[model samples]
Target: MKKIFVLDTNVLLHDPQAIFAFDDNEVIIPAVVLEEIDSKKRLADELGRNARSVSRLLDKMRGEGQLHEGIPLPKGGVLKVELNHKSFIRLQEMFGDVTNDNRILAVALNYRLEQEDLAASGTVTAAREVILVSKDVLVRIKADVLGVQAQDYLSDRIIMSSDIYSGYVTLFVHPAVIDEFYTYRYLAVEALQLPVQLNPNEFVILRDEMGSSKSALLRVSMDGGKLEPLYLSNDAVWGITARNAQQRMALELLLNDDIPLVTLNGKAGTGKTLLALAAGLMKVEDEHKYKKLLIARPVVPMGKDIGYLPGEKDEKLRPWMQPIYDNLEFLFDTKKSGDIDKILMGLGSIQVEALTYIRGRSIPGQFIIIDEAQNLTKHEVKTIVSRVGEGSKIVLMGDPEQIDHPYLDSISNGLTHIVERFKGESISGHMTLEKGERSKLAQLAADLL
Candidate 1:
């Protein structure tokens, strides 16, 4: 039973290649959707990039056949534009206005009605079922009220926007066990001794029965952290280096070229982004493991909006990227702000870009960092990830608990979605950092909050 998918303008704006994502299913792009895309084509951001890509894709399909009627897609699907006037009439009667979103909804509702009529006939049709797919939650709810089957486009990534792991934990181990490990340097365990919910790369602070002189560290190997790795280096991102046991494990995971996708989730002020940036810089800039260090992050406003600042693009981006700059300054030990700016200028090979311009371009052979990923929608995150070309490593870092998007909660953010989706994947890995190394005040606030 092949279904007819009526795509909303937001879906296309969220992902330009969304038409091809529904394999073998008939995709209907309402005329209103095209109009909306055209309207957004002039914006200089992700939305504009998607709009332009959609235009180029449709233009290329025009050479094959008529899009108004129907065209065969290379991926074995039918692409067509819905130009029915009845949809407008029905929309005007029901909603009283031809707003872009409502018009798109009308197109979907009209198609659904047509599908029912065709279903009554004895002849089977290619589109017996109609599915209105959009990223807007309210739109989907409205479609349900109109007696139409509507769904959110979720083909890009897995994991709900919430339920992402935070890297800190207080583990309860026996007093004798804690004392034994502190004295022996390694704890020999035969079975799973810790909590079942512990994720890889998570830090655990073991407390005695009396809760005193406990150790804080990372769990290097599976099976209750018994199999700790030998540490080779103490030089780490922050002043606090990964303990001998944690250092070896970090190096193993960081240097593995086979594992291209890595995620680090922690509270604000934790060394999640700094550690990832440090590891990336070390690998790409110091070790030459990658060709370039390409850093990007969502331009989400933290706290009150700064409005628009005056300057060139880079200068404008500097305010939003101040956190990134802080990390760079700390890593390079630039005592003065002017010296840090000079270093950033001198490091021509390192590209710090905004996530807005990543669409439609394929990036390969680079270490990409997507900071503050929790702000991105699942569709937006997919658009960024799909642009990864061959031989590229992508890392997503964010604090899921500190999401700022009005539509997205902790369960619907991109960071949580990526973590949940890639959990079982062998080539991908994730860690939740618990210790807030930024400062005592920051850590206290995170804990209290």
Candidate 2:
């Protein structure tokens, strides 16, 4: 049976290429959905970008064929811009008002009735399955009340929440493997009994099979041919040490100039941002491996209109970037409160800016840290990644369970998507920090409160 998939405006705004996702099926775009997209095409956010893309795609399709009748999609599906189904008399009698959502529901209801009529008259050869695709929860709920099939648009998701990659695995090995790993610092990949293929730079904890509580933190070689011991640092960064095993793994990836991309995820006080900043400072300031250290995060919980602040652009960003500044101050170990500002000015190798200015520039020989990256969409993350120039490293760190985006969640956010998509590659590494090392109170709050 051939199914008709109706796309909601939110689905198009979530992903502009959603029209062609259906395989060999009929795609329907309600006329009112276009109106909604038109109203949102002028904004300056990701939504605006997607809306314009959808508009351009529709206009290009019009040149190929008449959309009112039906146009052939490149993926063997038919795309139709539904007009003249705006009559909401049937819906108003049941669901009350005819808002944009209700109007879309009315179009879907009309499609169901038309299909049923064709089936009854033998005009249709088989049963037709009509489904409404939307990203809005309320729209899906309303669709269910009206006896319509609806589902969320998940074209960008690479994994389920429970199946998300954790970048590390535990193996029960012989006690002498730990002894050999400590003596020679490298173990052959085939020496251990494994269940799956290991990615480059993936961390592993080898425990004793005799249950003697013996373990070692080791990393898979970039060639996936051997397991190498972690380069445990004796000196701490600004009096901060890697308190847990995951933090040690994150530091290993961050400090390696060969790895161009790294991702870290953890809840509050897991030392993700703090550790990344520390490693970035070590690379840019001490070793001189990079020209500068640039840090940027999206301005969430408050939209990007900076007019209400009292001072200039930097001053406007002061409040939003204070958490970053606090970490820098802690790393620099300032005696007085105002001395950290002088240190930052003296170094001249650090830049703390907003994510808005990162779109159109080529950044080479720099270490870029994007904090709170889970709030970003997959497309936004792509834009940020494509701007990386030669000899540069980008670390994306965020807590997916703490996302603030209205349309994103733990499984669909860019942070999780990148972790899943870049797992087996040589240029990327990931770690999920489980412990909170800020303070006893903070750790207790993370666990109990």
Candidate 3:
């Protein structure tokens, strides 16, 4: 049975096309949602882009039919704008104030109550059910309190967002088994009984019984204890090399097209963003696998303020994107920082974008790198990913352990959530780089602090 999905304004901002994501289901856009979208349309960021997109989409649908009644969607669904004033009355009475969020919730509550009344009267309505879908946690909780069937938008369900795998696991194998793999080069599971927590392409260093001089690099295989070559490839772009085994695994995952979604976690100076940018440049500049190299990172600060940088838009962005520029300079072997700017200017194919402006744009055949993904909420990440057109690969890299957002942490951060949710899927892979290749001092500091 087709259900009535009442969309909240936050859901549309999280994904402008979310109205069409539900197959054949009737989508109801509350009248208050339009007011919310109109208010956000003036902002010059991702939110503004989404608000504009929703406005344009509604306009286009109006050409076909009236939105107040219902319009036929191209994807075989009914879309309607709910203008029920009864909901506004109910909302004003319940909440005592006409806040934007409360108004949206009121629309949902009215629809649910009407449905329940119809059901109680023994009338078999075609509307399967009324579900209030939102990206805001607070909104969903509010809906539940009002006795409505509220749910979070599943398009952003990357899972617990907490409890994401850190990609490093220490397995205590038998001393004799570690000895045999060193000499034989491959250890069969029959020979050594290890646990089942291992994954393919995962690296393990076999330690001796005494925990000294027994460290040997080994790759886990699908067929139980079968060990293979370390398989670190040297075909990396931008002259960047993996500083550690976990980095090697991360590089492999980033370069592999089969893995569309990759999540890299590490502390500062671990080179997660640098390696991803290098790989993207190589694929776009040399391999011609992609048409463009597009880099975007959240505008969150890391330990300092970016107060009042002088210049134009690009100059203002430069301060925020300096780390990316530094990596590009290192990759292009440019002697001076300005030389990297010249190279980027000369090659118009590469673009360094701010995550705030990625909404409502369809990026195709491009290698897109999203840095500092840990600062993004799950809703923000969904908004970015949904804009990916055909033949595009997006790599989300961040240090989950170093989130700066007050509302987000390791588990709730977008990067960690994507990694944990997409793990073991054929189209996605992840790696956590443990070894710090920045410097001896950096490594010691990371370990000690």
Q: Give the candidates in order of TM-score, highest first.
A: 2, 1, 3
What lDDT is reached at residue 291 by model 2? 99
Candidate maximizing TM-score? 2
TM-score for candidate 2, please give it: 0.93
lDDT string, candidate 3, 302-327, tens digits: 22233477876687788778889888
Q: What is the lDDT of candidate 3?
A: 0.76
Q: Write the residue-wise lDDT of candidate 1 on 186-278 in tens digits.
A: 654455365545544444556665757765444434333463433335565434366334333444455567768887777887677677777
User: Candidate 2 vs candidate 3: which has greater TM-score?
Assistant: 2
Model 1, global lDDT: 0.73
Ten residues in a row with the worst lDDT in model 2?
A: 300-309
Displacement of the residue 114 alpha carbon in candidate 2, Å: 3.1
Query: Which scores higher on lDDT, 1 or 3?
Result: 3
Off by over 4 Å in 3: 23-25, 38-44, 59-64, 72-77, 124-129, 158-177, 186-201, 205-216, 220-226, 229-263, 266-297, 300-370, 375-396, 400-429, 433-449
Residue 226 error, candidate 3, Å? 6.7
Clashes of each: 12, 0, 2
Residues 1-449, candidate 2, lDDT per residue (tens digit)? 77999999999988899998898999999999999999989988888888999999999999998998999988789999898564478678887876999888878877887888898999978659889998889989988888889999887678878888888998888899899998998999986758777899999999999999899989998888899988767458656788888888889999988899999999899999899999999899889999999999988732356568798999888888888999988888877877877888898999998888788799999999999999988888888998999999999999999888888889998889899999999899999999999988988998886
